[model samples]
Structures are given as C-alpha cells and as structure tokens.
Target: MHELSIVMNIIDIATEQVQQAHARKVDSIELEIGTMAGVEMDALDFSWSAAVRNTVLSDAERVVDRVPAIARCGNCGLEFRVSEPFMPCPACDNVLVEYLQGKELRVKSLVVS
Candidate 1:
C-alpha cells in the first residue's frame, strides 16, 4: 500500500525535524489529511506501527485531522460539501466545479522535547 510510503516519509520528516532542533524525542504529532487525499486510515495505522520502529516518532502520540472536501460551482458559485470528485452542484446542477479544499496530506504540528 502507498500508506507505507507515506508513513516512511513522515518518519523521515520527523527524524529531520528532531535532528534539526536537537531534540531527544517527539511527544506528539498532528496531521491534516483530507477525505480525497487517497490514503486509507486503516492502512496508514498499520504502516505507522511498522515504519516508526527506532524512529523519533516511535512513541509519539499521533493525531489526525480529517478535512472534508468542499467544492464551488463554476456556474452558480454555490459552495457545498463534496465526497467525491466531479460532483454536480446541487443548486445549479453544474458539472464544472472548483475544489475549495480537500486533497491535502501534511504534518500540521509537532511537540518535541
């Protein structure tokens, strides 16, 4: 699964941050993952357990903020929550839309010692 790679990347980032700050270890980490970020939470959790061994985030408390997808209609400019891509606007029934949010995967914050 790609979640393994994602977890590995997170470890790399945490390791670099710990070394850069000269910290002993990480206490917690906050992540922002969107509904359409193409990541499976279960897979990510499984991968995290294996990927974080002997790393700075091995014992860090992980918190994930799930971001809901939002879209705006190109024709009516109506904003609405979307679960999938290319959804028609409820108001105008327009297929052309612009994504306002979602599709995000980023580390938001870290608490280190």
Candidate 2:
C-alpha cells in the first residue's frame, strides 16, 4: 500500500527534525492531513507501528488533525465542503473550482526530548 511510503516519508521528516533539534527521542508529533490527501487511516496505522520501531518516534504520541476539503466554484463563486478532489460545484455543477483547503499533508509540530 502507499501508506507504507507515506509513513516512511513522515518518519524521514521526523528523523530530520529530531536530529536538527539535537534530541534522541520524541514526545509527540502533530500532523495535519487533509481529507482529500488520499491517505487511508487504517493502512497508515498499521504502517506506523512497524515504521517507528527503534526510531526517535518510537514512543512518541501521534496526533492528527483531519482537515475538511473546502472549495470555491469558479463559475458560480460558491464556497462549499468537498469530499473528494474531483468533486464538482454543487451550486452550478461547474468543474472549474478553486480549492481553499483540504489538500494538506504536513507536520504541524513536534515535542522533542
């Protein structure tokens, strides 16, 4: 699954941050992953358990904030919540839209120790 790669990428980022902070361990990590980020929670959880072994995040608590996808229709100038990336504007059924949010995948904060 792509979740393994995603988790590995996150581990890489955490490792770099921890090293840069001169920390041997991590207390917690906060992540902002959007609903439209194409991530599977179940797969991510399974991958996380295996990926964190013996790493800086081994004992770290992982907290994720799921951001809802919000988009604005270009044709009708309507703002609404979207479930997927390919969602059409409900106001005018326009394919042209501007994404306001919900495509984020990043580390928000980390507690190092």
Quote model 1's TM-score: 0.94
Best by lDDT: 1
Q: Poorest 10 consecutive residues of model 1 by lDDT?
A: 83-92
TM-score of 2: 0.93
Tens-digit lDDT track of model 2 for 1-113: 99899888888999999899898888999999988888988999999999899988899999999999999999989999997667899978999998898889899999998
Instruction: Evaluate all candidate structures by whole-model CA lDDT and list the values in order.
Output: 0.92, 0.91
Tell how far residue 56 is off in model 2, in angstroms: 0.5
**Residue-wise C-alpha lDDT for candidate 1, range 11-84, written one tens digit per residue:** 98988899999998999999999888899999999999998989899899999999999998999999999966
> Clashing residue pairs in candidate 2, if any?
none
